[model samples]
Target: MDALVGFTGPPSETLLRSMIATLMHRGKAPGEVFLQSNHASLARLQLSDDHAVGLRLDRRGLIDGDVTLLVCGFLTRDGTESPGGSVALSGLIAEYRARGVAALARLQGAAIVAIADETAGALHVARIGAGVRTVFYGRYTDPSAATSRWLVASEPKAITSAPAFQAAIRPAAIAQYLAFSFVPGSGTMLQDVFELPAGHAVTLSADGSSNLTNLFPFEDGEWDGRGDGDDHSHWVAESRRVIADAVARRLPVGEPVGIFLSGGLDSSIVAAEVARQHNHRVLTYAIHFGKHYPNELQFARSVADRLGTEHHEVMVNPRQFAPRLRQMIWHLDDPIGDPITQPNFELARRVSQDVRYVFNGEGGDPLFGGPKNLPMMMQHWYGVPREPGFREKAYLASYRRAYEEWSRVLHPRIRDQIDPERDLESILAPFFQQTSVRSFLNKLMAINIRLKGAHLILPKVERMLAASGLTPLAPLFDEELIRLSFQMPPRMKLRSGDEKWVLKRAYEDDLPREVIERPKSGMRVPVHFWFRGEMRRLAKKTLASRHVREAELFDPDRIRQLLRYDIEEGAGRYGMRLWMLMTFELWRRVVVDRDRTGVSGGR
Candidate 1:
């Protein structure tokens, strides 16, 4: 399951066999599963009987010629056939073959998909837009577009592992990772290799000509003329139906499941639905970062008590954070700056003990517009002047402060890439110019869908699969759920500074209003306080290490200055900067520097 099939050109029969051997875990099929092209570089997967239908090009309406394409990932929006994925993909492929041109459509599931058309002498590779499945492609010779060699893979580590290419760091992405605590867009921690953007696809012609295309076009669909009818309950009832259906489908019978209950609105909604439908008590897990971070035990216990389910909570310590920090860096494949990764990794480690399946509230932000961005969004939407309105001005002021703070801490090379003047253009410049209010909201959705959502859910899921063979079920990440959020009016999303206002109303009967109305408190890790206290020495030692200072990518002097200031001032601003540097150093040591001895803890 860890191994992914991708190469530069068409492979020999022996090479095809070797690729199949790498996937030794997949069981034997009734018919042939793996298919490769002698003329074109292509491979096809036959994971199930339905997948067999997708593997058969003859049955497919496309030219009925020999084209070996590996269709990875699920496409569920087309219909409801359990894994309605292969059906949607096959239909699109047949449509393209018949038209002999580009075929663009919205695919609901997370996948790293590649298709080769031998007859047309072209190949197409893509990651599902809002990229649930990881896809990476890079160049061997030059970083230029023409000299690039493309490889769409599921794991960043797999692409990094290619012996032919030296995995170098992208400093700009590293800076962004520090600021947002997650990499934005298609860029990853590794140089040149990019995660294909959500709602976008890249096509490589058989003649070696390449073009990247955006599949989902943003349209400002609205109902301004029509009144809301003031029926909030309708929105609530419909959301319940959609969420309940989505969860029920993902859970396989006779299997013990786990829910990452944060006692927040989103997870509470999921827990409520699970209790209503599922026969067994869904094993619920929570994370605590000592007393410094907000403790959700009391809130989570209330939800657990109401649902009559078993719950588990793991209190993480500094020692656990240090080791698991290195472990997550390895599994995450990309460098994400978020400290929440520590709590998530710890949660997965503990959850693996009780169950093999876990559900988390990843898509909640994008779906319901969680409290993080609500204050600013509400002010602007209601036509409040940016400088005069209290909420609007306060929000803009905070953003400007964050930008200035980030600018000061960032390395010059990274600072050069981002324009501070453009950065301060009222914060809504990017949203207004390119995307509609709805479309801009989708950008936030797209960000979480690609970065924060992927960072929080996928890495833990990957470790669970690698260690205990657990499968994570994220219903919020479901295609139907995303589409629902997109379709819902923005007014319902953040009314009166309440984040996830629509979600709360929808689950009102199922969840206590107190639980829904309470300020949002997801899993929190006290990395800032930790860096200033018990782990202070560890932080200093790691930043000052020879390996870190000598890493070819970063500026040694700049690194030293930032570390010195943070240690002396005890400001958490430098803690973020240090975490980004430390994660990169750890990644370089574990993933890139294999033969070294002192590669354990950076300090």
Candidate 2:
């Protein structure tokens, strides 16, 4: 992953170098700086060849006169033209010079772009469609110069590198993380430091004023006019065509590609397409806990054998990677409580040795339907006691994270600062209240794609893979595929009870019968067993430490109850809550506490 980091003020070579040091793990190349009269920008070169996907060197210039353009990820044209081909970086800069922020609408794919306009006295940073790439920005007054400055980076650690930037924990984001297991919307766990949302851009002027704009709006009714009338085959054919084109656009030329096959529908579909299209050898990787635990290797092996792919399997356990926990969380920049984060990071470490680009079936669940929505749909139709804010409550509870226990787990001082309505529910209110999307199911889909997909799923994957110096390709989350999903009738996605029906129908013949028909039991990380067995000692020591107690975040009694599994209501489900507490506590030490020693390997 290539990155750009700088501020909107007089050139400070020292500050630029400090920010660059924070992101050196992203790339080993020397950092390049472009200094101007009003602003300065620094870009780190990519380790892999940009021309692997037809991206020429001239098109991706770091500086262009009064305007400096810096891109973090690759951009591709819509399938109406070349499938995986990239739009020239030079062309994007030219468009920005002419049309300003409006030119962003023409850009597609998973990338983030930052433009510094010395002539206009303004700097702009935008995240392209579906947010596969992330850009975080914050505005603070430079204490030395007494002038306003905006610090931006690909990861939060870069912004925190500046000595003048004071980093503090944001309590409201803590509440949100407990509910969704990841921070939702533009706000991050760091106070005043915000993440740019998907299809959004932020502009900063010389005087420190800022403006945020949504370049690509996610409204529904726009797709109502499209789609063939009730003809199942039409949707099947169209879905197959659109998905195939997406996969084609992401395949790197003349290099072996890797697929993270879970034997699930999403990864299987991606593997099948990659195997069918790539002329070079296709490699597939899968993980299992051990022989004692339930595994998906049989199904994944079936897919690999059918496609004749060179398959490799790896085993991950708590003891093997516990020492690297702090390093993994530091790489995440923000805390994501998913138990699979370690596995994803470890898998990428192995995959990077063989391939530069890896593809997975990430968007299938959020875009099309997956089994996670079934519980919410059931509660929507037949839950008891329809009270106010029932939908929001039901949706939050569906995550099965710490939503129900958030208040109990938090210390009173910390809990008092958070309001469920203003902080948590407000994030979902706009999507649910909007009448533009008619169907109830589509509303849930909108929430899933916008909140979970952008904030959690995509960012988690990008950070994990990027940490190991590998670029991730998610064709299912393509802009064209996203639009095509909305045009599809909701029933077409969740037919009767089967999820992702259209996807299955599209590639029924290409996959094995067992693979296609088997219900989606995702790669379930055994957190519960680990808490009682392998990770038990580590969890107990970390959660009960003096640092955790003095921070006044979690109640000591509640932590004891969770460790003891004494709570009757959530018995046998305390592992997830303990994991969330452990992740946040560890993240707080490295990020907010500024404990550099903890980042390498925690005790």
Candidate 3:
């Protein structure tokens, strides 16, 4: 992966060089630069990635006077690629003359840019969308240097590479990760560092002050009330147009692109659009569990055959799945406890041999709404949410594990550090209390959109794909498409019990009725079956490792129940919980213990 990391205070050539050296191991490229300015030291590493277009811009960081500007990730303005031709920070400043960060914030795509200017006496950073691409920053006091320094990096592992930086796993974040499978909101595993919110810009002044600017999130009390009564057919047409535009914008120019064909409505819609654009000669990839596995390779084959595309399939099993944990967890800098994560990794690894970029249809569920949300919404309509007892029960209904389950598994000292009820309430508060979100369905969608898609799914896929020497793009995550989703009324999102109603209607003509009507069983990995077989030994050994035992995160007896084949509870799903715990322990060993072989940082 290409690297971009810098600090606004103090000059340390060693620190910047250390970061650049780390990027070399991830991929091979010569887009490297090192400059030590009077006020700060900066380093930028832009590796060879064909899937993303803006690395050339990153490679050409502007060194105008006392300022150094470095950009990472891709950007587009009003659906048009930015810095159109031979443009740089100096060019932007000369043209716009107002720092240009405001214009950067206005750009709509997945991007993060950092500019450090001594003349301006402040460092500026901006992210394009909600956590699809973002910056993680922190301020720590370095008494040894007799100065306090604030820093930012693409990943937390980069910050840990600097001198005086020690990696410590935050217990509160651990509790959230254990309960939700992902730490929510701004929290990270590190103590003083937190991710800069998506669609925001941060300016850290040389005088030791920082300020933030909101770029993409909907304002509190925000409501368009525009699509409240639009005609159904018209809305469907509009939805199709919006989705198509989003996909087209993300397609890399002069780069070979492939589509992830899953035989589901969202993926089929994406594949059909690619086919229409390419005159039916497309490169498509799919993954299955072989004959004994419950997979939809047949349906995927049907879609590919109808489109007349060259389709390739990767058959994955327990043996391949269990062995890649160390590297897979390392790529996923943050622990995301999803069972499908492994398949996403293996698919990207297999696909990278031929393609530079692969597009997957991911945002349809959260944006257009999806099935399996009916049960969650039932509580919202039929039960009283404000009641203290009811709220806790409802929250747990959505969470993976409960305190009772943890009580048996966690050390008392570790268990006492967290309050699950309060933590979960804080994360869900934004949606529950927003007066503008009138529909129960929108509230549910909002929670999932913010946490599930942004924090959990996107990070895992993006990083893992990059780790495999390929770039991953989710066109469905475009800001324009996401904004259009909010414009549609809730009824169109989940009409009656038919979830993602508008999405199905939009592509009904292009895709088969059976594919559109099928229930959302989503890429099922045989996690349960694996746990019953080969994965059982791996899970047991990892959970009982010396580092994990010394950390005292779990009880030996509770670990025993998980290690044994038969186990189930209201506390957690046997396979899923074991996965979460196993992943967490592995993360602590790799990230917390600073094991160099396990994790690849901007060293």
TM-score to true structure, per model: 0.80, 0.95, 0.90
> How do the candidates rank by TM-score, highest first?
2, 3, 1
Question: Residue 242 error for model 3, in Å?
Answer: 1.5
Provide C-alpha RMSD values for all models, in order: 5.6, 2.2, 3.2
Kindly list the per-residue Cα lDDT of model 3 for residues 43-121, writing each as its tens digit. 6566675434432342446667766766667655554453222234455444324645676655666667777768777
Higher-lDDT candidate of 2 and 3: 2
The clash numbers for all candidates, in the given order, read 8, 1, 1
- Model 1, 1-603: lDDT tens per residue? 223455455454543343334332322332233444634343433422333211112231122355444555444543434532234445666766665334545455545556666666555676554455555555443232234344545555545544455766665655455445556555666776776665667766544456777654333332232556356777777777789877776654565678988888778888888778777658887778777666888888888778877888778887766755565666566453566666676777687677656677667876677766654554456754544334323433432223334555455666677653333332334434443544444555544554456543454354434333344566777666666666666657766677777788777777766797788865655655676677777767766647544654555566777666634543556666666667666666766664334323211
What tens-digit string does per-residue lDDT give for candidate 2 at 274-325?
9999999899999999997999999999999999999999999998888888
| Candidate 1 Cα misplacement greater than 4 A, ranges | 1-3, 12-33, 39-64, 77-93, 99-106, 141-148, 206-209, 217-229, 291-293, 378-430, 435-468, 545-549, 552-572, 591-603
Which candidate order results from sorting by lDDT in descending order? 2, 3, 1
Off by over 4 Å in 2: 29-37, 40-44, 54-58, 62-65, 79-81, 84-86, 220-222, 225-228, 383-385, 598-603
Best candidate according to lDDT: 2
Q: Of 2 and 3, which scores higher on TM-score?
A: 2
Which structure is stronger by lDDT: 1 or 3? 3
